[model samples]
Every structure is written in C-alpha cells, then in structure tokens.
Target chain A: DAGVTQSPTHLIKTRGQQVTLRCSPKSGHDTVSWYQQALGQGPQFIFQYYEEEERQRGNFPDRFSGHQFPNYSSELNVNALLLGDSALYLCASSFGNPPSGYTFGSGTRLTVV
Target chain B: QKEVEQDPGPLSVPEGAIVSLNCTYSNSAFQYFMWYRQYSRKGPELLMYTYSSGNKEDGRFTAQVDKSSKYISLFIRDSQPSDSATYLCAMGPSQGGSEKLVFGKGTKLTVNP
Candidate 1:
C-alpha cells in the first residue's frame, strides 16, 4: 500500500563531487525511472531500469547513471556535479504495461554548490 | 524547439472556479498523455492519463488529448486550495519499446479561498 519513496530529501554537493539518491518503487511495480526537474522547468528523463538492466536513456551525459536492484528499488548517481545539476530528482515507478501511468516518489532535491 | 511546451503560469484563481491547463508537443510519436501535480518541494503525483487520444475524467479533473493538433489539456472543476500546485503535462510512446515521459515546464496554479 505504500507509494514510491525516495531518500535524502535534500542533498548538497560541490563541483567534482558525486551524489547518489535512492528510490523505492511502489509495491507491485517493477520498472523504475529517474528524472531531473530544474526550478521553473519540467522534468527531463534520465534513464529507466527494467529487469535489473538499463532499458532506455534520455539525452543526459555520462555523468548521470542509475541502477535498479532486484527488490525494485533504484539509485541515481551524478558525478562531477555542476551548479546546473542542482534540481529536484524525481523517481517514477511504472509497470511495463502500455497504458500504465507512472507513480512518482517525493523527489530528492539536489543542490550543487 | 522543446519537445513539449507549456506556459509556466503562476495562474491564480478563486475557489470553486474552473481552471484549465494545457500543453503542446512537437513529437508525433507520443501517444500516451498524462498529467501530474507537484506541490512545492515534492515529487509529482500522477493525476490522470490517456492513451492515444480522447478524454478521460476522474473526479474533478479531466484530461483531454488532441493528437491531431498535438495538444493536450487538463481541466479542474470546483477547484480548491488543495488543488494549488504545479500541473505538469507529460507524454511519450507506450512502454516496452520507448518508455519515457517528456514533460513540459509545469504550470503553477494557485486557488485562493
């Protein structure tokens, strides 16, 4: 009955440093996707994990990567953070169904200093 | 041009008024449409979704997708203060092949009592 959950509601990192954000998908869901939402802008797709492998990815650079565990929990890692990397990191969970809508977790706010 | 475009309005309205939110997409391949609501500092919550085209209503919210014009809309009736949030329009092709929600810059709505 629990919805998608994310950890480290807020984080701060400096240039050249890395940060990892965690997410636990909603119960009964298997696919996990990560998004980055900047202030005053909509989210940009980072990547998606299904069957413990990355299935699809967006236009993000190599600095962004993620993993999905067997339990359906996922983590997003960003390296060499820049000020532009500061944004709200959203974790959305969905089944592989065609019409399935994603259930989102309360995002982790990353502040690159 | 952005794949999806929306007016980032701090749209203000009175309680009980009808509110309309909209988005336009340039990608013709996008068939699954969705609306998500995000409160400040929170991840987006799925409001409603429509596959292909047509209208889908849930309680006070209605989502309309017009694929011909590549436009979509979300209407809120009898709006309440709790409805005040950033409404995001997201769309992409169904999962299993391409699974990502290309989102628009959210429209912020404020319903006053």
Candidate 2:
C-alpha cells in the first residue's frame, strides 16, 4: 500500500511571500496533520484536519493555515513567511478518533530566503 | 519550560553496544507515549508506542514509561549502523481530545562499525 505523499519536495521562498505545500494522505487514512521540524529539533505540531475541517491546532500564528479535501488530501499554506519559517514541513495521516499511529510523508523542505 | 526535555546527544558508540535514550515531560496529563526515529532531512518513523507505565519490547528496541516520574526511555540493544538516527520521544494525553503530540528535541545516536 502507498503511504503518505507530499508534493514540492523542496521550495525556496522569499520573506513576505506565500507558499503552499500539498499532501496526499496514506491510502485508507482519513485524517491529516501538519508539523514543522527545524534543524536538530523534533517535529512540532501545526494543525490537524479531520472530516475536512480543522479539529485541532497548535501554537502557530494565523499566518499558517491548512485545508483538507474530501479525498483526505491536504494543503498547508503559510503567508508572509519569515526566515524562521524555513524548516521541513511534514504531513502525517491516520484514521481514528485519537491516539492513532501516524504514517508520515517524507516532508517538504521550505527555505525562506 | 519546554513541555518535553531531552538531551540532544550526538552519542557515539560501537556496534553491538546497548544505547539508551531518555526524555522527561512536564505535563501531568500526558498518557500516550511514543518513540520515533528520523534520518537527516526525513520525516520521523514511528518506532514504538506505549500507554501509561509499562515496558514494551519490539525486537531489539524496548520502550519504557514511568508515568509517576513523567519520564520515558528507549533502549536499543545490539545497535547497528542502521540504527543511527535521531530518536524522538513524543507524548499526549489520551483524553485530551486530539491526536496532537508534543515532542522532545531528539537524541542523535551514531553507531560505528
């Protein structure tokens, strides 16, 4: 079975620009979550989309937003990016109410220049 | 203080040695614990997960959780070069109503031949 798939493996954007990263969740999964991992740090939770709506969010600012489609594909959009936003954006998928094991995609490397 | 604290160890050890990684969490509500392994620039791969205080063993890797002390540990036995990666400890409350995970900074281990 295919696992999660994320688009735009690598991206370089300038400060103040916007970027959209996409993800196709693993087959048989219906929930999508986004995370940001800086160099030498673990992935930090961004937000999670369930039932095509955001069900939970972390401490990220409003500049970070995401959407989930009916097919369980998701997109993470960052507006007015800053250098600190440069990191590996990861998309993970699972199917359950809570405490499900997440299958993660390779992730998109966002470089804010 | 950070919700999770871990020593970001670039620990070097010889092949076949036992490696221990640990993380301490400050959240008392956390009940679900997990360990993830991540290679450079790659998303984290779930290693093992345990709920509450108990010992879980999967092949050469073992996970232990001490809920009373708010501490968790991952032990790798007969370590191999392939086991060299950043090990992250993640936790969340089982009843907190979301799959959001708080993660540690991760411990980097290098097993030499």
Candidate 3:
C-alpha cells in the first residue's frame, strides 16, 4: 500500500507570489492535515480538512488555505507568500472516525527568495 | 508560554546507550500524545502514540505520558546511529476528529558509533 504522498519535493517562489502544494492521503484514510516546519523546529498545524471542508485551523494568517477533494487528496495554497513562508510543508493523513495514527509525507520544502 | 514546550537538545550519546526525550505542556485539554521522528530534510514519521497517562512501548522506543503533570517522555533503548534525528511531540484531544495537534519545538539526537 502506498503511504501519504506529496508533490514537488522542493519548491522556490518569490515574495508576493503564490504557491500551491498538493498531497494525496494514505489509502483508507479520510482526514488530511497540513503543517509547517521551520528549520530546527517542530511542525506547527496549519489546518485540517475533512469532507471537503476545513474543520480546524491554527493561528496562521488568512493567506494560508487548503482544499480537500472527494478522493481524499488535498492542496495547500499560500497567497502573498513572505520569506518567512519558506519552510517544509507536511501533509498527514489519518482516519477521522476513530482517530488512528497519522502517516506523513516527505513534505514539500518551499524556499522563498 | 507555548502550549507545548520541549528541550531542543543536540543530545549526543554512544551507541547502545539509553536516551530519554521529553516534553512539557501547559494545555490541560490535550488528551492524546504522539512522538514523531524526522531525519534531516524529511517529514516526521510517527513513532508511538499514547491516549492518556500511561506507558506504551514499541521495540526499543517507549512513550510515557503523565497528564496530571502535563509531561510526556520518549525513551530509546540500545540506540543506533540510524536513530539520529529530531524527535517531535504532538498532542490533541482524545475525540480527535477535528481537534488540532499542538507540537513541541522538537529535540535533536545523535547516536555516535
């Protein structure tokens, strides 16, 4: 079985630009969550998507948004990105019903210059 | 203060040594605890998870949660070089459907051969 997968293992964008990162949840999982990990820091929750709706969000700004498709794949969009946005974006999949263990992707590392 | 706080240690120990990693939280609502290991330039992988205050072990990794004291721990036995990485602690409510995970800053460990 395939684990959680994310697209563009690395990305580079400029300030004020927009970036879109994609994630496919692990098989048999329904919930998708996004996290941001700066260098030498643990991940900070961005938001979670279930049933195509964002359920819970962290303290991030409105520039960060996400979408979950019916197939359980998700996308994270960051608008007006700043240099501070350069970090590793992780996608984790879990079962929402019983809340099982999470499977995380290798993550997309974004570099804003 | 942050909801979850961890010592970001560049802890170096010899192979076969016992290692203890810990996190303390200020949020009493957190009901679920998790430990994640991440290598350099990679996303975190779930190591072990505990529901509440108790000890859970898997192989050489043990997770201990003391909710009453708001402290959690991960211990590695017979540590190996492959175990060198950053360890993260995450927590959320037991219900777990839409609850957000609060993460610590992570501790870095290096197992010297």
Worst 10 residues of 3 chain A by lDDT: A95-104
Q: Ranking under TM-score, best-scoring first?
A: 2, 3, 1
Model 2 chain A: ten consecutive residues of lowest lDDT = A94-103
Model 3 local distance difference test score:
0.92
Task: Estimate, for each residue in A7-104, the C-alpha lDDT of model 3 and write its tens digit.
Answer: 99999999999999999999999999999999988888899999999988888999999999999999999999999999999999999554767889
lDDT of 1 at A32: 95
Q: Rank candidates by DockQ, best first.
A: 1, 2, 3
* Clash pairs (backbone) in predicted model 3: none
> Which 10 consecutive positions of candidate 1 chain A have the poorest summed lDDT?
A92-101
- What would the per-residue lDDT of candidate 2 be over residues B16-107, giving only the tens digit for each residue? 99999999988888878999999988888999989789999999999999988989999999999999999999888523656788889999
DockQ of each: 0.91, 0.79, 0.78
**Stretches of candidate 3 above 4 Å error?**
B94-98
lDDT of 2 at B84: 90
- Badly placed stretches (over 4 Å) of model 1 are B94-97
For candidate 1, the TM-score is 0.96
Candidate 2, A2-109: lDDT as tens digits: 999999999999999999999999999999989999998888999999999998999899999999999999999999999999999999998875546788999999
Report lDDT (Cα) of residue B110, candidate 3.
98
Whole-structure CA lDDT of model 1: 0.91
TM-score between model 2 and native: 0.97
